[model samples]
Target: MRLSTVILPVRRWSEGGRDQWLRAESLGFHTAYTYDHLSWRSFREKTWFGAVPTLTAAAAVTSRLRLGTLVTSPNFRHPVTLAKELITLDDVSGGRVTLGIGAGGNGFDATTLGQEPWTPRERADHFGEFVPLLDRLLSEDSVSYDGTHYSAVEARNIPGCVQRPRLPFAVAATGPRGLKLAARHGQAWVTTGDPKLFEAGTPEQSLEAIAGQIGKLGAACEEIGRDVEELDKILLTGFTPDRGRPLESLDAFVDFAGRHFVLGITEIVVHAPIADSDFAADEKVFEQIATEGLAQLAG
Candidate 1:
């Protein structure tokens, strides 16, 4: 399995942030992703920068490592504007950009833009409209659309993306509607196990829950006559009950990854060590995992 890291946008680009991206590339990480948010859960009061700008800067500095948002959502983003930014980012990164997108949750991002939180059904509906329009905006030269949640009139992305039709999309979903969207539009599928199991469930239960979710995703793909194996299965670590266990050591991560690999996971994304945070871990160990963990799993 390919190993990646999520570098939270909490540090300023001048101070220690740029170093992290460089280090990730040097360590041979497949991709270095960041949280796309106005403000994330606990990092709300921290120095959270914008995801696009941070990624743009990262693209400038890194040559080999792919850059992406762990998940961008329709929360405070319009498809027209986001497509423009992503097209530019793809150009800047030399076609080394993947978009991890999802139906956003009822977090601080939900109400941050002077709007009420959307219900689950509303979020799903908005996502259905958002992903297709965004896909069109990136692929076609011009787009015009009217829909329940979003409308774009003669929106134009002239030069378009560097990545042929568009950049790859890693759709984050666990629910039926969301999984169907992923199956339809995604180059990859992402999950963080099951949220219900994050706080109280055992590791075994979390594994079972993810297996069930994968089964649903397969069914969703089958409904559309798409082969599920055509999409890469990605597990964004740290949300399952196993939490930091995988990052505890190189051996731990290999074991953790092996378990998921059996479940058809192709990519494993771990957080870049953030001292004293929910994502805190040993930096050396994380680097070891980046460099050697996947090889160990193969062996």
Candidate 2:
């Protein structure tokens, strides 16, 4: 599987954001991404640490790595305004941005921000219409269209998105309907979890289950005439391990997770130890595993 880079817990690790982002380039990660946060407003906040500016700063410093908000919910951003920001960032990244979008999920994001959340059905419907509007605004000069949730007059957006007509649009999905919706609209899917979540079986069997579910998603894409192979379906297995083990156990987990990740996603971003753990043994174990694992895999 391809190895993409990620920066996680962005909500908590705001201080080290740029320094570590610059560090990822040397670590041989293909992309640097962070989760979107719009809520949890403390008494004070800085705007630069938010998702888009973080990406912009990362883009300015790095020449090779890709950049994007791992995702930002559309509910937080109106389509036209988001399209503008994405276009500007795409220019900054020189077309390396992967614009991941979704219907709102966390109620904290909505209720706390006073941005009323949508039902699952509403999210699905909004998701369907969201991408098409993005497609229209970025590519066409005039987008005179109307949908249940949004409408746009036949007006041109000056200086549209950077990656040609259809930029890299990924859907953040977990459930069946969401997956199907991802197939129909997303150029890729972003998922996060640990590999132990799967069953005990041959790696091939595990891969088959993942591929089967993805095949269903791909079939849905086929109905819409989008090529399945072209889509970058990826698993975000943040391989969070507990303690030290022999190289054999670490190797097995890394390779096994890599196989399933390949079957499911175009890339896998290893979730390494964060170094603030209580037990030094656990830290050492996961560090040994991640270090050896990346050494072998990146090789």
Candidate 3:
């Protein structure tokens, strides 16, 4: 299985951000992603940076380390503008960009733009519209569309993306509607286990939940006559009941990864160590995992 890391954009590049990204590349991470948000929870009071700009800087400094947002959402983004930025980012990164997108939750981003948080149904509807429109905006030179939640009138993205039709999309979804969208448009699928199990569920329960979600994803692909294996199944760690267990040691991580790999997971993403934070971990062990975890798993 491929191993990757998520470096939260909570530091200024000159201060320490640049080193984290450079280290990720040197350690052979498959991709180093960041949370795409104006300000994430808890980090709201910290030195959070914008995702695109941070990624652009990272792209300038690193080679062979793919970069992307753990997720970008329609919470405060318009497809037309986002497409333009992504096209440029793809070029900047030399076609090493994957868009991990989702139907945003009712978090700080939901109301930071002076709008009420969307209901579950409304979020689903907006996401359904957003993904397709963004797809067209990136693939075609010009696009014009009208929908309940978004519109694009003669929008132009000339020269398009460096990744053929467009860069790859890693759709983050667990629900039926969202999974259907992922099956239809994604090159990969992402999940952080189940949120309901984050606080009170056991690791075993989390495993079962993820297995069910994968089964649904497979069914969704089958419905469209697409092979489920065509899409990489990625598990972004730290949100499940297992939380930091997988990163406790090389053996712990290998065991954790092996269990999920058996369930058809092709990629596992862990958070880069952050001292005294929710994502806090031993930097040495993290680097070790980055360097040797996959090889050990293979052995």
**Model 2, 1-299: lDDT tens per residue?**
55565565443344775667666776666676766666433312433246777777788888888876667776666676677777778888889888777666645565655656777777777777777787677776567777787788775676776777756877777566767768766778866432453434443454555676677777777777888787786665532231222223567656655566556566665443344432123434444554465566555
Off by over 4 Å in 1: none
Of 1 and 2, the candidate ahead on lDDT is 1
Local distance difference test, each candidate: 0.94, 0.64, 0.95
Q: Between candidates 2 and 3, name the one with more favorable TM-score.
A: 3
TM-score of each: 0.99, 0.77, 0.99
Q: What are the root-mean-square deviations of the candidates from the true structure over C-alphas? A: 0.7, 5.0, 0.6
What lDDT tens digits, residue by residue, belong to model 3 across residues 201-234? 9999999999999999999999999999999999
Candidate No. with top lDDT: 3
Rank all candidate structures by their lDDT, best first, as comma-separated numbers. 3, 1, 2
- Clash number for each model: 0, 3, 0
Give the local distance difference test score of model 3. 0.95
Please identify which of the two predictions, 1 or 3, would achieve the higher lDDT against the true structure: 3
**Candidate 1 lDDT (Cα, whole model)?**
0.94
Which clashing pairs does model 2 show? 233-265, 234-265, 244-285
What's the lDDT for candidate 2?
0.64
